[model samples]
Structure formats: structure tokens, C-alpha cells
Target: MPPRNAARLYPLVLLLLAFVAFPLYWMASTSLKPQTEVFRVPPTFVPETWTLRHYVELFWLTDFGLLFVNSLKVCLVSTGLALVVGSLGAYALARFRVRGKEAYGRLVLLAYMFPGALLVIPLLLLFRQLGLTNSHLGLSLAYLTFAVPFVMWVMRDFFASVPVDLEEAALIDGASRLGALWDVVLPQAVPGLIATGIFAFLFAWNEYLFALILISDESLRTLPPGMMRFVSTTDTNWGLIMAASTLATLPMALAFGLIQRYLVTGLGAGGVKG
Candidate 1:
């Protein structure tokens, strides 16, 4: 592209970023503002009076802390499972000469594209039959439906980028197939793993519909559904809501920040090499 064209698009790109970022900024800002300033006349773009009362109430006076912990457990376990299973499945599909390999690849992508809403009812019933409903294990399993497929699809491409020669050399050195995978291929795929793991964790952490439907016990509520409990017919605590929202967003932001250096390269490296 010409310098003139790039200059013309710069403003539009910044505008789009601002549009997306403003809501998050507003949420964080609102969480810090006192209730009095939340709906003040002319609306304060910046808070004049900051307070931590909402955070105090959210943590000390309510079960939000427990809810946050439950979410973390479910998401962490789900992401781990997804990474293990998806990586193995991806490696098989990439390295092995299996029958209907293309069809199986398409099927994995199709599974990922399936609507979560549509799966909710059947999953609920299935969990009940298995006596896993209302439990964190069941919730993690629910997350696996989508997480596994996403990891598998991304990892399949990533594994394709890894040269067969490396694995063959390891094999000739008397390393078993699994040993070669662990010692040779997996290290090269770290970036892809980190990127995919982030996606899996974020999805499981942020999902509300399945959590709400599957988990009836308040103790098991994740952040998104737990946050919703703040609203009621008689009253809605905006300060508390904003505070909870801010807290819930922090983990995902921190996770992304830690792996961001690898994310871009991890996502693109496979494409370049494959």
C-alpha cells in the first residue's frame, strides 16, 4: 500500500480501536467511582470521588469470592483437558495416514461451529443421567465440547508445520513415538499451545448459559452467571455489578498479557511453515 493510503486509513483504525476500548474503560472507571457520581448530572467522564466500598461488599459481604474461585477451578481444569486431548488428536490427524482424514478434520471444525445454545438442553439431560449435573466436573465437561474442537483445529495446523524429519530422527535414536512427541515436537509447538490454551480458558471462564443451566447450586456459579445475580426486580446495584465485572475481566487480561509475545508468532508461524 502507498504511504498516502496508509495515512488515510490510520484515523479509521484508531477510531475503531477507541470504539472497542471505550466500553472497557468505562467499566473500569465506573467500578472505581462512588455511587453518588455514577449518575451525576452531565455525567463525569472521570470520577471525582473514588471508592472501594463496592469491592469490599462484593468480597466480604457476598459469595462473589467463592463464585470467582469456582470459575477458576472449572476453567483451569477444562483448559488442561482440552490441551492434552486436542494436542494428541491433532498430532494423530497431522502425522498419521488415517482413513477419511480430510473428512475428520472438517468434522472437528463443524463441531466447533455448532451452536452452544442448541447443545444446552441435551447436555443438561445427559449430565443428569450421568449424575454429573450441578458439579464442577460436569461443567468442565460441558466446556470441553467447544474447547477440544478449537484446540484440535488450531493444533492440527500447528503440528503440520513441524517437520517429519525431526520426529524420524528421534525415532531412529530409539525414542518411542510418544517420547519423540514430548521431547521434540511439543517444544516447537509451545506458542500454539499457549495461544490455544488462552482461548480455552477464556471461553470456559466467560461462559454463562451452560453454567447457569447446568449449575443450580450457588456455590458452583461462575463469574458471568454469578454477576447476573446482582440484578433483581426491586433493586440493581450498579456499583457492585461494575466492580464484579472489573474483577472478572482481570484474569483474562493478565493471561493474554503474559502470552501476548508468543500469541502473534504462534498463530502465524504454523501458516508460514506449513
Candidate 2:
């Protein structure tokens, strides 16, 4: 690139960074500020006086810890189930020449594209009849509808990129299909698995619409729904709200950082030309 073009691109790059980082910076700043200082007209870049009161109040005055635990449990269980089921389904689709395989693959893709907003009411009613409303199990299962299909489709592509000869040789050596998958194919797909796990985890963690409508009890509420309870007609606590937002986003940041290497690997794995 020419120097002039590179200079022109620098402003755009800075703008993107500012757009993404400013909200996080504001949240963190607000979290540290006193409630009175949060909305001061002459906004201070740094807190004039720092306070841990909001964080303390969030934990003790509210059920933030319990809500965090609830969210964590739902995210972990749903992601784990999605990864296991999606991987197996993906492997079968990629390796086995079943009738209607193409149609089945398209069906899986279609499921991912399906709108969740349209199904929320019916899903709630179904869950109510099944005695799963306001339950963690029900929430996890609902998440699986989207997470499983997404993971399966992504993993199918990843598995297809792997050399089939490796699994074939393992099978020829008296290994069972499952054994070959467990011992041979899985190791090669570790990067893809990490990527899929991250995707599933985020979907389960950040899901709001379903969690909001399905859960009613305060104790059963996940972070998203629990956060909503903070807003009321009388008042809004911006400091505490920002603190909660910052805390809610931390796990996702850590998850992405941990899996970033695997994400890059998975993206690049299939691009090598023969």
C-alpha cells in the first residue's frame, strides 16, 4: 500500500477501535464512580473519587452471586451437550454416505437460520406443559435448538477438511467406528471443537429473550433476566448497572481470548490447496 493510502486507513482503524473500546471503557469508569458522579455534566475521564460500593452493594444487597451461578450452570451444561451431540452428528454427516445426506445437511443449515423470536411463545407453552418452565434444564434444552445446529454445521465443514484416510486406516486396523472417531478424528479436530464450544457458550450465556420470558422466579433468573430487574419506573442506578454489565462481559472476553488461536487455526485449516 502507498503511504497516502495507509495514512487514510489509519483513521478508519482508529474509529473502529474507538467504537468497540469506548463502551467498555465507559462501563469500567462508571463502575468505579459514585452514583452521584456517574451522570455529572462535566464528565470526568477518571473517577474523581473511586469507590467499591457499587460492587459490594451488587453482591450483598442483590442476588448477583446466585444469578451468576445460575447463568454459569446453564451455559456450561448447554455448551457441553451441544458440543458432544453436534460433533457426533457432524462426524456421521461428513463420513457416512447415508441417503438424503445432502438434504439432511441443508435441513441442519436451515435450522440455524430459523428465527427464535417466532418460536418463543410456542416453546414457552411446550415447556409449561412439560413442567420445565423456570427450570435450568428447560433453558438449556431451548438453547440447544440453536447451538446444536450451529455447532453441527460448522463442525461438519471442519471434519470434511480432515483426511478421511486416517479414519479409514484406523477402521482397517480393527478399530470400531466410534473408536476411530474418539482416537483419530477427534484429536485432529481440536481447534474446531474449541471454536464450536466458544460459540455455544456465548449463545447460552448471552441469550436474553428466551431467558426473560421463560423464567419468573428471582432465584431461577439468569444474569440477563436478573439484570432487567434492576430497571424500574422509579429510578435507575447507572453505576451499579454499569458494574453488572462489565462483570457480565468478563467471562465472554476470557473465553474468546482462550479460543482465539483455535479459531484462527480452524479458519485456515481448509484453505490449503492440494
**Best candidate according to TM-score:** 1
Clash counts for all predictions: 0, 0
TM-score of each: 0.95, 0.92
The runs of at least 3 residues in candidate 2 whose Cα sits more than 4 Å from the true structure, single-residue gaps closed, are: 1-11, 270-274
lDDT of 1 by residue, 205-256 (tens): 8898999999999877888888888999998888899899999998888878
lDDT of 2 by residue, 1-274 (tens): 9999999999999999999999899999999999889989999989999999999999989898999999999999999999999999989988899999868976986875668898789999999999999899999999999999888887887888889999999999999999999999999999988888887899888899989988888889999989987889999998889889999999888877877988888756623421
Top candidate on lDDT is 1
- Estimate the Cα RMSD of every predicted model relative to the unseen true structure: 1.7, 2.4
Model 2 residue 213 distance off true place after TM-score fit, in angstroms: 2.1
| Deviation from native of the Cα of residue 98 in model 1, angstroms | 0.8
Shift of residue 79 alpha carbon in model 2, Å: 0.4
Off by over 4 Å in 1: 1-9, 272-274
